[model samples]
Target: MPFKRPLLSSHTTDDSESQSDSSHGGPSKRRRVSSPRNIEKDKTVLVYILQAKIDPEMMSELAMLVENYKVERGNESLEGPTSVSELNLELTGDVEKADVIVTATNMRQRLERHVEWRIAKTKAIVTPLWLQDSVKSGRPVPYGSYIAVHHLEDETSRSHDTVQDASSGSPSNMPSEAEKQSCWQTEPTELIDTTEVELLSHTAKYSCLRPSPLVCPNQSLVKEIDVIRQGRNVEGEERSMLSYSRAISVIKAYPHVITKHNIRDLHELPFLGVKILSMIEEFLKTGQITEAQRMLADPRFQSLSAFITIHGIGPHTARRLYDLGLRTLEELERYYEVKPGVSDEETMPLLDAEASANTEAAGEQSIKIGLALRHDLGQTIPRDEVEEINGTIMRELGHIQKGCKSVIAGGYRRGKPQSNDVDIVITHTDWNLGSQKVKGLCRKLVQRLHEQGLVTHVMHLSGFHEHNVLRTHHWDSLEKALTVFVSRHNSSRQNVYRRVDLIFTAPEVFWTAVVGWTGSTMFERDLRLWAKQQKGMKFDSSGISRRHDSKLYHPRTERDVFKVLGLVYIHPTLRNADA
Candidate 1:
């Protein structure tokens, strides 16, 4: 026979009419009225429980406790009944409209999949213990102690063991037990194998030797390291920044999902130091890096990062501005203006008058223009806008000279949805033209664009004269102009300034220039590194040269360049080495 549960009821109140009838001493009548306990039930704290991995008996008890629970308000009002708080706890179904979510420790990742979990920043996600304790104590407890961590079976350990067993036949294929032990000094549960996993087919050291896609499986970990890398760059720690960048590139190129079980694969890669490895382990354990979080929350670092984004502002200038007590772009703008009776010593105590004067004279106009149009220039250029801009440039180029070809490089060619700037490489099929002809074509294109109200400002123009060409040694010495551009047909009805770089290359190195300009920085860096170290060739945007004899090799196509370097041609979309 099944047992029947008893129903709980609140105290009833007597109606005023019933009291008046009893006072009249006639045949008295009684009526029931709603009580404060029933009124308190109207206002409830909604809690949704994720039942995975929780004991059935415990869950049953929790449901009963929640149904009978009342949050004690403590005797603040000594003269009246204490305020009552009721619980509207649910053990099953969706978490919509829930103020709190209680789940098992191992179910954090599952809880994160809920849309409400991410959108509601104030919603509390706690362990079952929090709810149990809250009911026992008659109030919601502090969430700090109950934030969940995974306590399920360690899949990483099982996967690592499987790979180790599979590679046992070839001892040299696996890292020695001592090396694996040394990689992590914590308890056995925290140990991470520092050798390459057999499951991963590729373990190349150079980024050019592997494929790195834009969507990385380890993006969360990559983001934390990038934050720290940016902080180092802003602080002018070049060595540290390069270290983080190398680690980032390696991580991005890694094809497998990064987990504690397979983290040892990163150890096989070059450029990742013990510090970076420790941070990776920390993130896998806690979903955050302490150093990265601290830097993100630092006010001074925030100010410096903002300043570095301004045109013509580098790390040193950003630091100097910070030293002068300037914490924002507006403050820096005010400082740049000429003020009467404001001596250099009074305004910039950190620098001498001569140094201040030299800094002011250098790039003053560029800085002023950058500040004036910061908002317009800072907006990202969508793919459609980039295409429209490219069309405009092509039209102007056709008017200036016939039979010219062009390609939009940079992130656009790499298939990015949006880009910070537009880089266009133009060249003619005719190879008989002299270098002066190419320079003249570039000059005419800029002039035409300016006359058409497209080129609003010219930040730089190079390689147009013989002296400028002789002064530079690289292929980047191609005729080029960096200008601020605005389309005459802006559908947004606003003057949106865009940074446009126009590079005019000779027909011989046009493909090479395209490859150079369309790059993820690490991919290009590794390509050059591979050429110099392995092929004994110097590679750049201009062309590749045999370092042994200074003989130049002109690759007519992008594939020819890769073939000469002995690298598998990677599509631009797969060249995202997140440096």
Candidate 2:
């Protein structure tokens, strides 16, 4: 029996079922939330729960679509289970606050019976997996309607640092219809009325792209960190100045930074904020922050990241796991598995198992990879060498086509000067002869580099066709000559464990392409919101388009893209993830 959740805002519903459950030892109580807006007045609620693997590589891009869509409609979209006992406690109350309910059909068997909706009309949008289940059950998903879409892949282009467009539109507040479609549009495929249950594997375009690990303990941390580094340039200034990256210098040493002083003294230190203070204090007393503690106890992280940390799981995914109620990798391993491989069903806390297994696996992978590549990609290669390799790759392609233009984006373009991977965006007048031919060009280039003994363990991707909107690809072995990954020593002298992403775009969306690829994802997200909320347009890493009419848009330059979005151009450094 589930409990009822309190959602006292726009609508109301009775939860006698939860009350009954509570009378039998539960925590079901009625309460309400005061929201500033009453979006439930006469609209529907669409709740998307990711029940499958989520490709982190595409997270920033998907966020663009979600955030932009909401702004375009001036609507409020709420998520989070808010509580367990969800059906008896929360759902009944939450649904009453809306005129309609829309959920991904994936949980048809798992959640449908647990949380029953009695509304006259309920809508279910089936993904490929959900569709298969529906067909197997001989069900029509008797709801408002079912729409199956490849949400992540349809138009996942990179975002520019600022304004994200500037490919075909002028610096104005409004983007023409043409500009809108260039960014996003529906590409309907054959009806997914399949009756098969065969498992299909999917991959994100940039599944190999990963988050940077935390600051190294062996290395000194940055000091002279500028506080409030970025702000809108007053009329006297341009767009908000970007955040400071490289610290001027560590002029002072603060000892035992964590325990040297209390929150008060820490506040007096450079760059410490209330939030950061809380995190530090929590860690000092209990050896962890609330989030970290919660994360450690969750099953997913314990099983996944904790163990996967050996493979470089970052803070972003750790938090996402915590949010999913998985406190440890152990829990993740033991809990809700779509595939039944691990068998330890004694029903202990779900997250603990995940954490243990995750830790063990991470340790093993680290030992294996570190030993293999210790002599190779050990210390950072000279920035010059990193650039030289990329330059060589691009120049080789250019030799294949005289006027082809190739740009290295991602952290390299962001001025990291040092990076774990290299991403190249190409465009040319003869698109087919130049950019469109990158897949073959990359193979020849990498093979040639290998023959010269200047290239080591390598992976290359072309035509990254994304399948499922949720979990996509594990790019480790999905490339040309992936066997190089087996190297015991990842040497960067010539080419040690290097990840490269190559993408080709039409000349029409060339600028958009550049903007999308040249991004601090955070800055890109902000610019996208600016366009949708202020300019009545949808902005993505791929293209800019009209919101009302759902049209494609293009801007020729980065400045024009921002101008059209009613914003000044933002620099890459200013794009902080926390922002």
Candidate 3:
């Protein structure tokens, strides 16, 4: 049984005296200081200040009051007065020694990494209010109401308690043997046909071979799993994130709604591991995953997700920013604020030398631009706007070089209602122009667009030579410009800033470029995987190349590329694998 704090005596007259003083129009009398008899003299308390919002001075004052009260007790031991020095007013990096930890932030957010181990050690983790109440009541307060419960801690404790109860021959919450066996033995009366299940099991292995629609019957379930996946991504769990992605792809391609009736069949699908299947089972039973819910509500996850949405920031950088305590875009902007006469060390004291150097090399300018246009860039681009933006680029390209054809790809090509950005693959049929000339196309077109007030900012430009023109062998190594485009809406009279990618490839590989740029990420990924594994060939935005001999095959059309790879041509509209 858990230890319970003793209740304060009801004979105490402090409350009545304070009320009498107030009613008589006199100054409220201060309550007399009393030593807390219930507190263990040697127990160590650590006050950890996590967030910037918490006042250190208040913690110090509270610690001083507690310490002074302990000293007033004059409790003597063999060495003399009992050590009032056991209490830590500041974070001392010795978490193991703390009997009680009072923190400002949520316990799950702060100590989630090792919460189970910490709980197993029997540490009483609570909020600052616990300490305040303990001091006010002249005794340590009951930890039941003040305990900061981490979700994982609760699960760990329940499992531990169940095991202990079973060993001790006490009534336990653990499922009975008969109940456990029934879960797997019980089958639904209406089941999917065995032949259909076999066919689905075979086809579901490769996402590229299947038609994944933008809208799926299991979208709600997929969304919850995806949130957990996103949380893993933010935490830099590469393998776990990929596993979740694979599971989500399989679920999205599933044509029917996921209910308990067909959940047993889901185990047949590729990438649906025991863990993922368990999550699906839990979701089917409760309509939500506990882990996903906790992650969705975590401030740290929210901040990291927001940071990675910026153009230049990746998971690693976003994690670093979170470590620096930057929670919002506004806070990030302030962190990068350049003040005159202040050194970098003074401006960003939290950043170490190595991090500072990495920041300078990591396109800080592009990140700042992303921050400035965060709202505009975050807005989804409708199909109409996507076409309009494509048209604007095409017009500008025609002026620079006639017969320059452009293909609008990305989510728009896959038939999504809205896209996050525009990807355009531009190529010319003039053989005389050569590879050298094609390399300069992106730079020239972007310059023309910038002059015309269409291209606002160039985030990145690559695959261009400065002095001597180099011959490019593959379409994947084509010249490209990542630019921000601004278009005016006539009705709203507002300038909408959009992200655009212009890929300039030679005419010979034009079809391959179109095939590469038109993608749902998993579709392209599996295409490459299948080509390498099954066909003994390498595939990319570039044309096909034989892996054995390294000879490139020029694809005349998008269908030709699929034909070369021995696959039936999947229409662009049906290429939404894990959309």
Candidate 4:
């Protein structure tokens, strides 16, 4: 739908048996004509899917791609509304007639099927460089069940013919003699360059959602990165082939897409997608992704990845262990399992198995938080940490519940070295089971922990800002909150000093607040942009409500919350400190 042309293809048949077949003129070929006016701006519908919701880089890529397509085709084509369902209805008054669903990775299976079975009669394109593998491998497009692939083969053949005729100082099949003498011909159909933008990537790449799934949000990039990574630890000749990794893969998937690439003269390679080409006649000046894939083969990162997989480790911990000359699970085992009689550390300090076991427990949970954040907050946290930085009264003072509904978030989630404190969110199943006794369970947990001394201190619950935030709160009574204090004792001679926050959440606001409180400040700000600026919805630390009507929208799960925001769901572990 980001295309400037209406008809997908136009072809000419050889005249050998045309008259005998009774076909209509054997389908005369034609070319697209340019218009000097803005075309896409006048469309009634637009469906814009975001691959990296909070990525400055990827969003910039998408905008450029859209604008460029307009300039090249000399037409303004509308995709559809931002919402997918609305685009499907074919409502007469709907301003969106086009469906431009975007994603950070490959098109998801469900959304693809939805478009395939139900929304078949529409236009859609899923961007993001990560989609190269899926699109090339014949996986369904995330936009819908079937793709309206713009046919450039016929155009290619036409262009070839036209060039051949011109080389001889004349177009052989001109409409008339006057047209034949013309030095210039009309615009020939060609394959419009597809857009491939990445939302953002600092040291780590983030999926559109904070952390939901293990797969990359951009399917193509994921596959390509995997292809590159898997090809690592190679022999002499294989290592030499590394430099051409990205370009070779991109060209392979789309041979004619890069009709030309002068790799030798290029310095840094950049992938502009369709946007830059609109502005510059030669956006793809070189046949490279532009940045020059230098760090494509990172043996160190792969090794760190291996080290962090141990039981009690996080990224930071693993990194430190690596620095200390212990780089893998095997090395750690070697150190701890030295011969029984060896005085290597007596000579070496004793390596107690139990101490390591406790660390392993922490590391195992850290992995969970990481996986949970894959789509919820796409970057991985340290080996034993979650990703966010919030510590409410309940989580900081929470009891080790058998089933108290617990999730660790914040710096602790990201596996930081000595966090100031831990943030935990809790709610009893019967928090609102139609009786005060049932609801009292939440408050009771705080009391039980306080009595047990796991909590060292407690902060009085603060009232809501008593000021405007998203214009949704009533009377400013602190958004219906609750908290409690507790203290913990240490076996050492020194007193312990750390605070924990345990928040009792109502069913209606549980998921939203759980995720909100579990986020990094930056990532949460991005969520705000999606809510207030993009989706016309309102999200607060307390709950998610409708923008126009101030209707409180209670999501049954975190996935639903992401769905309404027009984003892919991320998991916990991947949320990282950025979330």
Q: Tens-digit lDDT track for model 2 on 382-493?
A: 4565556557666666655555555566666555646655566655544234335433444555555555544443322233222222325521101122212212132543
lDDT tens string, model 4, 1-579?
A: 232222111111112224313442443233222433222212122334342332665555444544344343232112433311101101111213333334433333334443442342243433343123222322211221112222122232343243223222223332222211111111112222122112223212222332322222233333433333333412223443333232322222221222235332222222323422321223244323222243344555555666554323555665676778875555655554533212121100101122233444434433433222222223232323222222333354344332234455455543345444456654433323312222444334444544555432222332233234455555221122122122223245242333445555554455676668666553566577678877888775567767677666655455446666766544443344221
Report the number of clashing residue pairs per model.
1, 86, 0, 108
At residue 398, candidate 1 shows an lDDT of 85
RMSD of each: 27.1, 27.5, 29.7, 24.2
Question: For each candidate, what TM-score against the reference?
Answer: 0.60, 0.36, 0.60, 0.32
lDDT of 3: 0.64
lDDT of 1 by residue, 1-579 (tens): 211232122111123224434654744222222432112222234566655565666656666666555222323223353543322233323455555566663343454565343433445556677678666544444443354432211232232233223222223223332322222211113112121122122458777776676878888999999999999999999988988988898888777887888988778878888999999999999999999999999999999999988777889989988998999888876887733212122212111222224445435645665666677677788989998999889988888777677788898887789899999988875554634357557667877787787876665565632222233643453777777788544666756778899998876567778888888888898889999999998888777778767676665556556767877656677678874
Q: Tell me how candidate 4 scores on lDDT.
A: 0.37
Instruction: Sort the predicted structures by lDDT, highest score first.
Output: 1, 3, 2, 4
Q: Candidate 2 — worst ten consecutive residues by lDDT sum?
A: 200-209
- What's model 3's lDDT at 33? 23
Against the correct fold, how does model 3 do in TM-score? 0.60
Q: After superposition, how far is residue 181 of candidate 2 from its true place, in Å?
A: 26
Candidate 2 local Cα displacement, residue 200, angstroms? 46
- What lDDT is reached at residue 23 by model 2? 55
